[model samples]
Target: MGILLRHIFILIIIGCSLSVTVIKTGWSEDLLFFTEQYPPYNFTGPNGKVSGISTEIVQEIMKRTGFAYRLKLTPWKRAYELTLSQKNTCLFTTGRTTERENLFKWITPLTENPIVLFARPTSTIKIMQLSDLSEYRIGGYLGDAAVDYLVTRNIPVETVRDDKLNVRKLQGGRIDLWVTGEMAGQALADKTGHDIKKIFTLTAIAGGIACNLHLSNLITTRLQQELNTLYQEGFIDRIYQKYNPDLPVPVYKTK
Candidate 1:
């Protein structure tokens, strides 16, 4: 009877140790990050590595947290859907919209993403409000919060696969205005050598990291705390300065 009891005790101890190891692995497994080719935020550089404003910020956060991770640059729609469906995955430089507020655990306010309307430099279109442009044709891209915002307001907007196409459409007079994030539009325009001017600032939303719903809150909470520390330490500011020294650094908002 004493020998039998000792074997049972050993089994219970081994089971408990295995359970703890499983829990630790679940929390510390390498994270996968997804992002789109929205330049100046997250994009593939000429060297073919992902590097940009939000990309750098996220890299710093991961480094400080000592989390093993891999980042991929893909189409916006693909990245959005993959992040939505996968566990232990995250999407960054995502706009924090009401429609997406509860979809994922968030680490936010990485950058200011002011939705704006860009028109050809010679164009005379004016927009005082979103409704003011009802008479004019508008263009937006897929997987962008601005597209959803327009559709929600019952606004008619032609859709494209990418924002760069909208820049081309605006240049070709196919669309009167291109609605997109301010910095992204500027970067695209500059890259394509097309001069576009911002005609209206529709609304400002913060860009953030959106982790999968099943992602452990423990990881999210730890990352959020590290992000806040980065902001407080002006590390985020220095990153923005490296990208665009003229643009004002976005203020961090804790949730």
Candidate 2:
């Protein structure tokens, strides 16, 4: 009976070792992707799953790459910070700005959205130049490239946690203008039934997947290649059409 017990104990130890190995292997194979609640780009749908144009694009790319990944909807600031600090982590629909050029390894030009200023439809706000923005109370969201662009030019901005809130603020006369992406602004306005108009186009910006500085070049290269194929095959155009049939699809570049 003692001999039988010893044999059973040995089998248990081997089984425990195999389980640990499987767990570690699964963990190492998985990648984590983060994004904010930017609509028609990346957002939590009514069914509680993350689904949008950019989210769909990323999912297809990962499927092509055969890499296991987790997509999480988080605050913009937290998502950006996690991509910056965590390995095997990435953020999608990130603006590829000159100031951020050196911070992360990029798989770029996933989106070519123009940053713009929005205001109430009835407001007569003329913005012929960037300097004119300093005269009004400009509202924006935290960790957005549009806000950074304005702040770098010495323009003061009121920031909030969500860009959607700015639409309400504009309606309430709390802010004179709101700075955000053209697509995002329109989506927010339409969803909230707010009447807002684009007052001025700030600048055209390309957005993409931003990976940590320490991420493997292999993974970045694979994602870029897959994205290029998607663009060439018109898969991306279909995604854009599904979201907004009238909006022009963002051009993607191989380089």
lDDT digits (tens) for residues 94-117 of candidate 2? 999988999999987678888999
Estimate, for each residue in 1-255, the C-alpha lDDT of model 1 and write its tens digit: 999999999999999999898778877778999998888989988898999989998999999988889998878898899989999999988998999999999998788888988999999887777778889899999879988888889998999887889989999999998989888899999999999999888899888999999998778998999999998998988898888887657777755
Every candidate's lDDT: 0.89, 0.89
Worst 10 residues of 2 by lDDT: 21-30
Candidate 2 colliding pairs, count: 0
After superposition on all C-alphas, the RMSD of every candidate to the true structure, in Å, is 2.6, 7.5
Model 1 lDDT, residue 68, Cα: 85
TM values, all candidates: 0.91, 0.87
User: Which candidate gets the maximum TM-score versus the true structure?
Assistant: 1
- Point out the worst 10-residue segment of candidate 1 by lDDT: 246-255
